[model samples]
Target: MTAPTPIVLLHAFPLDHRMWDEVAAGLARTHEVLAPDLPVALGEPLPEPALEHAADAVAGAIRATGPGPAVVVGLSMGGYVALALLERHPELVAALALVDTKSTADTPEAAAKRRQVADAVQEAGSVDPVRAMPDVLLGETTRSARPDVVERVTAWIGEQDPARVSWAQRAMAARPDRTDVLRAFDGPVTVVVGDEDSVTGTDAAEHMVAAVEQALLVVVPRVGHLSAVEDADAVRSALADLAQRVHDPVA
Candidate 1:
């Protein structure tokens, strides 16, 4: 029998690999799932504020898993890193799942806001500046109906080191557009977004889908930016299907 394909889970910013706990657990039953915390996560030393650094970490993780490419699933900031990884180390990726993320670089105003948040976080020596992100990161349905999830997201943000938060924010601000990376990749791609994800909603997802040849777009209902956390089942199902396509491209 053939070995199950490896799956690498890259997490969103201001959060750790733990954000993928539920989805990783579900996928691990059928695939080798590896969720590595990005740079400065879990008390690691701060690296240069660049997505390439994060992508290198992911490449190392994939290499450690053994030879051959792994299915890469990245959410939000993770998605940016995933695109970077694809551009820098294409051979390590068998397929990709981009969830609640966009391939385009942040606009000038958005990048400026990120820098401002970073500055505030560093000056305050706390993750307080981004503490209220759940309001924008989560959909109205989740905020009103799933208080536990909202609290969980808030707690994750609180757990991040202030300096690391600043570093991540700046790193994201410095990233460039990678849609061409997707256009060049021959592997199957899955684009997932919460129907209510205001940050990178359906429009962004559609843009990514149109960039790739074999792309699957999944717009999950009643969720928001953190679709994987808000609706793990939907995300899990989509990933499992993507893995299957990777395992049997001709099927």
Candidate 2:
């Protein structure tokens, strides 16, 4: 029997690999799943703010597994790293699942806002500046119905180091557009978004889907930017299906 394909899970910003705990656990039953924390998410000291560095780390993790390519699943900031990894180390990725992320670079205003937040976080010497992010990151439905999830995300943000938060914000601000990279990739692609994801809503998801020739778009209902966290089972189901397609294209 053939070995199960490897699956690399990259997490969203302000949160570590723990964000993928549920989904990873489910997928691990059928695949070789690995969820690596992006730079600073786990309080790792990064020399500079650059998603490229994070992508390099991810590439290294993938390489450590074996010679073959792996299926890459990224959410939010993780998506940026995935695209960067694809551009810088295309041979390492066999398929992609970009969730709650966009393909375009940040707008000037958005980038500036990120820098401003970084400055505040650095000056305060605390993650306080972004402490309220869970409110915006989560959907109205979740905020109202799932207090546990809200508390969970808030706690995760609180655990991040202030300097790391600032570094991640700046790093995200500096990322480039990678739609072309997606367009060039002929591998199967899965684009997932929460209907209530105000951050990078359906529009962003659609843009990514349009960029890729073979893409599956899943618009999960009633969740927000953190679809994987808010609706792990939905996200897990989508990923499992994507893996099947990757492992058996004809099936």
Identify the candidate with maximal lDDT: 1
Cα lDDT for residue 38, candidate 1: 79
Q: Residue by residue across 1-251, what tens digits does model 1's lDDT show?
A: 88978999999988988889999999989889999877623335676799998898789888888998999999999999999999999999999999999999999999999999999999999999999999999999999999999999999989988988899899999999999999999999999999999999999999999999879999999999999999999999999999999878854
Q: How do the residues 1-251 of candidate 2 rate in per-residue lDDT, one tens digit apiece? A: 77877999999978888899999999999889989877723334566898988888888899889988999999999999999999999999988999999989999999999999999999999989999999989999999999999999999999987877888899999999999999999988999999999999999999999998779999999999999999999999999998888778854
- Model 1 weakest 10-residue run by lDDT: 39-48
Error of 2 at 29 (Å): 0.6
The lDDT values for all models are 0.92, 0.91
lDDT (Cα, 0-100) at 37 in candidate 1: 77
Model 2 Cα shift for residue 170 (angstroms): 0.7
As for candidate 2, its clashing pairs are none
